[model samples]
Target: MQQHKVLLLAIASVLLAMVTIQSGASIAKQLFPVIGPEGTTALRVGFSALMLWLVFRPWRHLPKGRNWRAVIVYGLCLGGMNLLFYLAIARIPLGIGVALEFTGPLAVALFSSRRRLDLLWVALALGGILLLLPDMRSVDALDPIGVLFALAAGACWAGYILFGQRAGNLASGGTTVALGMTVAACFLVPIGVFNAGSALLSFEVIPLAIAVAALSSALPYSLEMVALKNLSAQSFSVLMSLEPAIAALAGFILLSELLTFTQWLAILLVMAASLGSTLSTQKKPAAAS
Candidate 1:
């Protein structure tokens, strides 16, 4: 009973994290006209780094030598992932971008697990992503550039997962994440300033950016850390299958973005594949490395 309750709590934390993260993304979309995606990403990541540093103070003991390599790669991946994702959403709808980005973790799970059943899950996930690409002849087709950006984001996400695992092995989990985020801000802050110019410093933009950092970065990361500590990695990943769906719903409700029935079905298929892949595989203790 105690274990079951812990699992339930972990599930709830993951679910709440998904909601807040996606809601923050939807809200960030509203800022595009003023600061552009690059600027928004900078604000989100920059502020997140600041807030996390204040909370965790990872600077107290910096990683040295080989450990620094892991942290740098982890930080770079986070920076690239955010930059590409925001760019993708600038051209495409939020839900589609999220679905595409989700392919990273799904691919990781498929590649990591060696089971005959995993093939089916892989196929289902591929088919769902393919469904998002309607005929090029269609007037309402997704932007090719946007799709490319999302795909790139997915690649960075895969790197983030791998490098993050390494960094987790090297340092305190919370400290690792906080320092990685700081490095991410270092990479993005310059680009943001150049692209948005002085507009990046607009007083009106500050409040929304702060809110986004709290919702999308700080709170979600903290909750996921707690959840991961208690749940098996398989359980954690399976629970996260709900993210694309939650993002879709958030886009619809908060941004007034709607998807076709077919698009909705595609999202469902991917969600199913994500759930199946994690659940069918034997549970593994959450990797701290």
Candidate 2:
């Protein structure tokens, strides 16, 4: 029953994450004509912070203690990770951005890997990135700046993974998420306002922003928590392999973004790396829903 529950959670997290990325990207595009990347990410995370705060009531607790320190770390990474990723998406195709973003967790997994066999997975992951890097005369102008944003996002993502773990450990069953979410929003909300202006305050963007907040932030975390209840850390990481592939497919289905055969192969290689690492590593502690 426990194993089965974990499996269910893992699958649910993958599907939800896919949907979250797809919807968030689509909404960002919609907001593009109006507010731009800074505005879009700001709205999404801003509203997300409100929702999390409402639920967790971070203000009720004093921040002078460990909670404040934990949130500082989590917020710093979360804010940077989101801002960079949004910038990356604004530059490149969503799928490509995600594929590159996977490098963070991949690097972490490989670095901590005990198995000599994991090197093969690293090679495959690197190969995937290589396949995506060649200049295609046929494709639209690629943004070198966007690629830089993605690398920046990748670095932040690694920080997110590491800090999240640290926060979780420090909180010891407390939900520190609200504090982190709130602080990240605080960091970005001002920039979004300056960039988007009163348009950020418009009624038209509200529903879409709410939907995006739920899809991208709320649902993914909830489902991931549920799944962690059942899966080992290694198994969970392996399952995350679907994130890039799903993002790509979501782009195709929702945003009318298409990919070349070479791109598809690149994604496949990354998946193989994730799978190999997951299967070869030892299990993590059971997750809590």
Candidate 3:
């Protein structure tokens, strides 16, 4: 019964985290005109790093010895993921961008498990993504560059997951995340500064930037850590698979962006495949013998 309760709480936490993140992303989109996507990425990363430092006091638990390598790689992945995602969304709709970015984690999950049934899930996910691809003759298709950027972000996300696992072994989750974010800020701040120039420092945008940081990074990250404590990775992945849909809804409600029926179906197919993959893995552990 206790396990059941924890699982329920984990589901709620991850759902809430997804909402917060997508909502934050919608809010960030509004700031694009003022700071551009690169600038927004910088503000979000910079503010998140600052907030994480204040909260976690990472200085007290700095990476030592060989541990620095994992932390560095983790941070670089985090930086690349955020920067590329922002760039993708700047040109593409938020929902589609998220759906595309998800391919990375889905790929990681598919490759990590040896279950034969996992291939079906991969096929389904790939089919769904293919459905979202720009039609060769349609002038209204999404920007090709944007799609490529989101795919790159997805790749970075896979790296972030792998590197994060290594970094998790070296320090507390919070400390690892805080330090990783700091390093990410180091990588992005210069690009933001160069792109946005003095505009990034505008007093009017500070509060908006802070809010984005809280919603997109600090709050969601904390919630995910808590959720992870009670949920198996399979369950967590299944729950997280709901994010693209949530992002689509958020985009519609907050940004007036609407997805076509086909796009919505594509998102559903991906979600179904992800959930199926998790359920299949749970039912058939590799060491069942």
Candidate 4:
């Protein structure tokens, strides 16, 4: 009974993290007209870094030697992922952008697996991507540039996962993430300031930017850590497969972004692929045993 309660709490934590992340994206989108996506990314990352440093004090365990290289690359990937994701969503609907970006991790999973069953997941993901391609004849077609940016963000996400593991091995999760966020802030804050100028410092924008940082990064990261502590990695990965759908629901409710039938189907296909891939990975170990 105690184990069941703990598992339930962990599941809830993961779900809450997804909702918080998508909610942050919805709020951040609101800032685009005021400060642009660049500015918004800057504020989100900058404030996130500040909050993390205060909480984790990662400076105490700085990465050294080759670990520094890993963390640097990890941080660059983290920064690039956020920057491109914001840019993508500025042009596309939040749900679609998230779904497209999810391909990065999905690709990482599929490529690492040699199992024949993985092909099914790959095919499903490919079908979704194909369906998302802009149809000039359709009034609701997605922007090509936005699609490219989202795909690029996904690539960065894959890199983040790969490099993050290396960095995580070198330090505690909190320390690695804190230092990584600091690196991201250092790289992105300048571009934001250049793009938004003094608007970033406006009284009106500050509060919302902080909220974006909290909702998107700080809170979710904390919750994920809790979930990670209590849950098996396979369970966590399977739960995370729900992210695109949660993002879609959040976009619809918070931003009033409506998806066309085909787009909705595409999102489902991607979600299905992600879920299948995660489950397959879990089964692999059991089968080998």
Instruction: Judging by lDDT against the true structure, name the best candidate.
Output: 4
How many clashes (backbone N, Cα, C below 3 Å) per candidate?
1, 3, 0, 0
lDDT agreement with native, every candidate: 0.89, 0.78, 0.90, 0.95
What is candidate 1's local distance difference test score? 0.89
Model 3 per-residue lDDT tens digits across residues 23-118: 999999999999999999999999999999998898988878898999999999999999999999998889999998988888887888987789
Global local distance difference test of model 4: 0.95
lDDT per residue, candidate 2, 1-289, as tens digits? Answer: 9867757767777677667867777667667677888888899999888887666665666356755776688888889988898888887778888888888878887898656688799899999888777475755645778877887888888887888887776553235677777779988999999998889888988788788888888777777777677666666676777788888887787778888888889888988887887766654323311
User: What is the C-alpha lDDT profile of model 4 across 114-167, one tens digit per residue?
Assistant: 988999999999999999989889777889999999999999999999999999
Those runs of model 2 whose alpha carbons end farther than 4 Å from true positions after fitting are: 1-10, 60-63, 134-141, 172-174, 283-289
Write candidate 1's Cα lDDT for 162-270 as tens digits.
9999998987888998989988999899999889989888999999999988999999988998899898777788778888889999999998888988888888888
Which candidate number has the best TM-score? 4
Per-model TM values vs. the true structure: 0.94, 0.88, 0.94, 0.98
Candidate 1: which stretches are off by over 4 Å?
1-7, 283-289
Weakest lDDT window of 10 consecutive positions for candidate 2: 280-289
> TM-score of predicted model 3?
0.94
RMSD of 3: 1.7
**Order of all candidates by lDDT, from best down to worst?**
4, 3, 1, 2
